[model samples]
Target: MLPAAAGYDRGITVFSPDGRLYQVEYAIETVRRGTLALGIKSTDGVILAVEEKTRKLQISNVTQKIFQIDDHIGLAAAGYIPDARTQVDHARFFAQSNRLIYDEVVDVEGVAKNLADMAQQYTQYAGARPFGVALILAGVDKNGIGLYLTDPSGTYIGYDAVAIGAGSEQVTEHLEKNYRNDISLDKACVLAIESIFMVSEEKTGTKHIRLAVIDSKSKTLRMMPLEEIENYSKQVQDKESQS
Candidate 1:
């Protein structure tokens, strides 16, 4: 009842009448997974930030895996963290497979497009309302610093910068005003956390936030801490006072 190649990436070698079992990893051993956010900068440098608490810290256990498929690309997002990880897992496998054939990091865009394709598939599995996930994918591809926000329903939005999750509205508003054609990584880092807070404050129910940046120079991903983000939040107040 299943194609011979169906679910090939997950190590399914045989065609079973029923679907195969998928093993979920424990969070504590992982890097940074769960309800989070991300930011990418393409200025003189690159930086990425993420909240340590993970999903408002309400859950007793959460993973801190910063889903980075390649050294050049990074991902931060929200909703169904495990599903997001699966998307990343697929991308990682593709990147590895491509490297074996072409011997490079593999095309970042191609990898992203493949991910978009999977997002739609993930949505279809849900009977109603659709099982969902959203992503702020950032990295340095062949053309250079690329940014995109992709949804679980197989739709994606390309951007120089983007935000996802509980504070997306607030973050989007901040981007409209402060996001210029180019800016320093330092400035972008501070702005990133503030946007998440802007929404967190309004909802009065948000806690964790994660951010990432893709450096145009070295093509690296940097994740920041909550304390560092809090410091930047205070600076915003100081700057506001001067203004």
Candidate 2:
């Protein structure tokens, strides 16, 4: 026999009898299956990190999931990468448009809201499928540091520290237990590495990791080099030894 949800699952615009949108839920599920990605907002700045598995022969220098949306805004993604690229392009255009029109950089929350609205529209339209991804958006702006998560449901919420994708429940719990509002930017980098090591397959190396920082001092986005990431990993290891 066919299930009750069988018919509704076929259309993005259709809702199941229980008022649930199966297509949207399925899109979110795609995010759950992706690798780990997280963001941390420290007193001095924001950190964006992601774990990306690479082929043994593939180039490892280029990051596949983290993106710089503007001078002060960056994001880490989990789920269908093509979808992430699409959303990022949209965000870049929006950010630039805001700059041209307002003569000011777009705030982090504004970009989050814009992407969430775009994600939501796909749910109401018949021929479109929801974006199969979720993003951790973090940056520094006039209001100080901002961190937010945007999901396939078109919902956006702010957070001090947050993780998404596989094993995020465990990772999020770790962040909640250890996160502090006054945490320093350097410590936050180590903490991000520790959180990823808790679940990532590449436990001992910096090759699979990608990091970007938007600091209050600079108010600009910059990718961390492998050498710097290695230094933070050493700190993580030293702390583990002490405990």
Candidate 3:
């Protein structure tokens, strides 16, 4: 636990002597405690994967980390689930509004930028706390497949690959060594699943992983069925054994 820096972190609008928002830093810590969520952008498409955890045995095991913002846009979030849901709702609204007003789908960066603007407001406004989550937005747009990462501080950026939440360091290392610009969508999906498995503390299987993909050919966003995820996991294992 970090020692309270006396009068600096108590308020969201207060900045420390070094010009850091302690509250935002603390909100980022909340994201670090959540299960891993990762995205990989390849030549053919973008793949997003997330770890699913059930707090109770009686609860459903379905994961809510991956959401379809529109036909061509998807998001994966790590951190406070409720905050993530709120952001997803905002993204959906923006996408629909863009279609209605402009007669075209919202660009990938536009969605991210709008959400970041909303998040940034919380940090500047009095009595409002920063969101305790991080998001990875992936989509297919006119320019091609795009992958973006955003944090509670309202900062957003594009990435070829990214990992957030617990065990991100390990997953990031794996991606650095294996990720390639020309990797196929199928291979990217497998790589994402494998990377998640490497960092998860709990034993995860196909049933515990959620995957979404956006490709140029399909021009649509879709989540993979459990059976397909299982097959991909097997392929990954087979390739590992061969080497």
Best by TM-score: 2
Name the candidate that leads on lDDT. Answer: 2
Model 3 lDDT tens row, 1-243? 455477898899887888889999989999999999999998888989999876556454455899999999999999998999999999999999999999999999999999899889999998789999999999999988889999999999999999999999899999999998889989999899888778766544666688988888887988888899999999878887898
For candidate 2, write residues 1-243 as lDDT tens digits.
Answer: 238788889999988898989999999999999999999989899999999999889987789999989989999999999999999999999999999999999999999999999999999998889999999999998988999999999999999999999999999999999999999999999999999999987779899889999989999999999999999999999999999
The positional error of residue 1 in candidate 3, measured at the CA in angstroms, is 6.9
**TM-score for every candidate vs. truth?**
0.70, 0.98, 0.95
Off by over 4 Å in 2: none
- The residue ranges of model 1 lying beyond 4 angstroms of the native Cα positions read 1-36, 45-65, 123-131, 202-209, 225-231
- Count residue pairs with overlapping backbones in model 2: 0
Global lDDT of each candidate: 0.59, 0.94, 0.90
In order of lDDT, best first, we have: 2, 3, 1
Task: Tell me how candidate 3 scores on lDDT.
Answer: 0.90
Candidate 3 Cα deviation (angstroms), residue 85: 0.8
